[model samples]
Target: MKNKLTRIICTTLAFGFLALPSAQAAESEFSLDRLVITALRAEMKDLDTPASVTVRTGEELKATGALTVADALQFIEGINMYSQGPYGQSAGRMSSEIVIRGAKKGTLVMVNGAPVNMNGLFQLDNILLENVEKVEVIRGAGSVMYGSEAFGGVINIITKKQVDNSISSSIGSFGRHSHSLNLQAGKLAFSGSLVEGGETGNVTSTSTKYTNYTGSEKISLNGAYRFTDKLVMNYTHSKDDINKEDISLSTNNRQQYSNDQESVDRFSFQYQDDTLLANVYGAFREIDYYTRNNDGSVPLPTMGGYPRKADVHTNLKTAKYGLDTNKQWEVRNNKYLAGITLETEKYEQNKVIMTKASAPASPVITNQQTGPFERNVIALYTQATHQIDDERKIILGVRGQKTEAEQGKEYTQLLPQLQYNEKIGESSSWFVNIGKAFRLPTLTEMYVTSDRFTGNPNLKPQSGWSYETGWKKQIATGAVKATYFVLDMNDYIETDSTAAKMYQNFDQYRNQGLEVSWEDKLSDKFSYTVGGVVSNPQAYYNRNWSRLYSRVQGTLGLHYTLDKVSANLSANYITDRANDAPPAFPVSLTVNYKAQPETTVFATVRNVLNRHDVTTESTPSSMSGYFYGAPRTIEIGVKHSF
Candidate 1:
């Protein structure tokens, strides 16, 4: 493993791209002052924030032709993105999910600096980049400033707010078609997109077995009115709909289809000045889903007398509301931010099953239950930053949260953090950060009951501590960075297959990792970026597998530009380090040509190697299940700006 990793890193450096570590520079041609907010919940210089952060500009994302935020995040280091297939392909466990530092459930996802992770599942695949300005990622515990579900890190998708207007359309492989538009006029901004497509061949089995198809549409509107130079009112609303087929869990032999519909509305009134900034806001999220399983063939009495045919239907609905207030003050060389957040969520589910046996032994089950499974959370947090000297600073923060669930379970938690940063030389700086973080069980994990799995109301929240240190160097061309981090976790929540297939507080785990990355512009027309990470994990969960993540992973990219053309070649590698290892090594190439000032043509060939043989075992029971990767595919698109 070490030799292979060394070869990968050496090969990348041989191409004049040295692999360093995490944290991204905010400075881009289209950004303002190179400022980021995910690290501190306030705008701070990219390299100055006392955390390991990474930023991907909207332009960079657009260049990648990624249909979703989850797709775009795969290029960064220290993050393990597992997908059954390319971008929109795959279902169930193969669907896209991110793991940072071997921590999957501890990540916090947000949009416009507000928590948007729904139902405690960290699925960000639905967040398209049509109107996003940038994505900021803070890799490490962030609960001290962002509250719960930040045990591993924070990912904040910042939308475009400046005045701008553009439109584009594209058609690609597998009957894929999409259209998008972004418009901004004075205080009003609107962006929307429509996409429809599915796999041309079978998703998993051969001969087009899994009937795969997916379609999604979304619209967002934001309006901000300046009441005065010191005050403003902002309103934002968004609606998204997704319809697709669920390949179902590999363990399930049933074919299923599902649909998800969601809508969100937010309003905020704010007051800001040189010395003070405050805001009051209210938001709501409504999510609805429907699923049906079709098993057309039934068994006869001669064939073991199993159910000849069966049909299952499920419906789930959730409503979430949030009210929050935040205020910040600046006193001399000291800065302080204080905020309070209140949230309430309610969920309901219904299921029905009908089965037909060989003879007169037919059974039907209908379970209709309305839990209004409720959850209420109140949190208060404050952070202070003090400049110790000309080149040194310290940050201190703390947060307290009270949570109440419908099951009458109540709990309170406190998170604290400390960080120090210093300038070592004219072009180098270093930082050390330590923090405590936690994640409360989601409503689904606590109250939802299903035929295959049961919820445990007694499951406790997972809490942990993280320690991180890093050094960064700003060079004339680009930059280099390296980060080392460790996480000690307790009361981890995982499915227990030992008995009734239930959720439980399994055990504890420790993860230590190192990351190094570098990006450089060698010339006016050539640029390259490379990064790699190594994670060592120890699991004490009484499970056979000690680590569920790859021991070594890396990414490399080379880009070239001409007056009217641009091209990029990238590669990613993941070492099989888990007990039931699933390794991936995919390479891709992309090119864009500006046929005219207002028109551009693009082509992308992903998985150019066509290496889809990667496989892994099933979960929970750890049975003989199999998972694969996306096959090689090509896509061509054209866009026109208006």
Candidate 2:
């Protein structure tokens, strides 16, 4: 590993040297507009953000065939997907979740700047990435700006706005395909897309073989109309349905049926002029999950089986209304920003479970449940950027939020954040930030109950403090960024691991890490990027039980463009992880691909060596069930645009 890393460093430096003369000659053509601007609220240059941020553009997404957000995020550094399979499946221990800088998926996900997390269940599918124009990732705590559940990081998905009339389509492996269209005219714009796909294969579990079938379909619409110069209206709607048949975990020979349906609608009004800006928006989302499991003869005493059947269904609905107001003013020789926001969310979940077994036995169990939860949060925040001198600036901000949960139980928290940026020279700058963040227990974690899992109503909120410092250098030919960060969490909430597992609050953890990255346009036809991260995380529970956390990962990538053709190859490696235990089998990999512009001719391969490494581990009891990485599969496809 060391030798490979050394060779990579040398090759990168050599390329930079070879391209220096041309870079200097073309310096006059360089413009800030060519650089991507992330939606980090401050509108700072991507290289100047206090936290590590990565931007993946729509063009890149198309070239990579990234049908989901998880797929798109695979090339980024320090991000990993824990899923049952390549296609998103609810079972098999691999949840459709993303781990960022070693933090779990409960991290905040935002669309445009509004929270989209439903009832603390991050149900966002990568299908949304189809219409995504760009994604902005903040690699550390952002609760000061985004509210609770921003403990690890924030991923903001910015959807495409019509800039021109266009249509595109493609068909690929696993019976997958997609179509999209966009139209723009003056102040009126509209876009729509459809995605349909399916999978059929033989799946094996515990030495038992079963046929699996999975399919999904989605439709979306977005439009914007300008009523006047100061006010505009925008609307969006989306619906998705998925169904599958697969083998069960406990009964490896028995087959089960599962289905999911989700829908979302959003409307917003924006008024802006000069120094004042305001936005008011309303959003609604619903998700439904249904499952049917089969039990064969020879009823087990523990499970109460023999010709048994179980049906489980869950429904969730959320309504959110929020308003944001921001005003900019000058104080002394600096600019100051003041903002106030009010948001209210009403959430409800209904679960029904029924079971019947044995021709002669009556219904053994039946459950009809309703869980209602509501939260009202109001926040006032103020921030100021002071120019202390020609090369130094400081940002000070504070936010206070009052939250009311179910039964009018209220909680309030005061979070303060500070950042400093200093220009060391014409080509270098340094930045540092310190802030606090918190996460409230999810409704599922508080009140939901079933034969498999139980909830705790007395769960307490988790809070943490995070700090990071980094330096960025834009040299004559490339840019380099490196940061070190640490997080100390208290009152962490995790499932209890005793004999009869239940929800508990006797866990605390600490995560610390380093991230280093370099990107260079070695030449007009060739550009490359490389990044690496190392993290050390540990968890402590029951006062004396301590263990290393799972998901310490790393990544490297290279991108080259020649005329109308481009190629990108990325390699990701993750060390073995543990949950309150010791290290297990680590996941390591090298994925590579290339694409041609306008031809739809693409070739790619994953797990080139066919390494059967487990990418994740189960929590609580620390079971070692494994998820198989793709075994050297190759894909070829064509795409067209009009």
**Residue 157 accuracy (lDDT) in model 2:** 71
Off by over 4 Å in 1: 1-33, 84-95, 200-310, 355-365, 543-545, 577-579, 613-629
Model 1, residue 194: distance off in Å is 1.6
Each prediction's TM-score versus the true structure: 0.83, 0.82
- The lDDT, on a scale of 0 to 1, for candidate 2 is 0.63
Q: Per-residue lDDT for 534-642 in model 2, tens only?
A: 8876566656445444545556555554334445555566565664333322211211222433234555544434444444444545443444433334455444444
Q: Which candidate is the best by lDDT?
A: 1
lDDT of 1 by residue, 413-447 (tens): 99999999998767778999999888888787787
Score each candidate by Cα lDDT: 0.68, 0.63
TM-score of 1: 0.83
Deviation of model 2 at 445, angstroms: 1.4
Winner by TM-score: 1
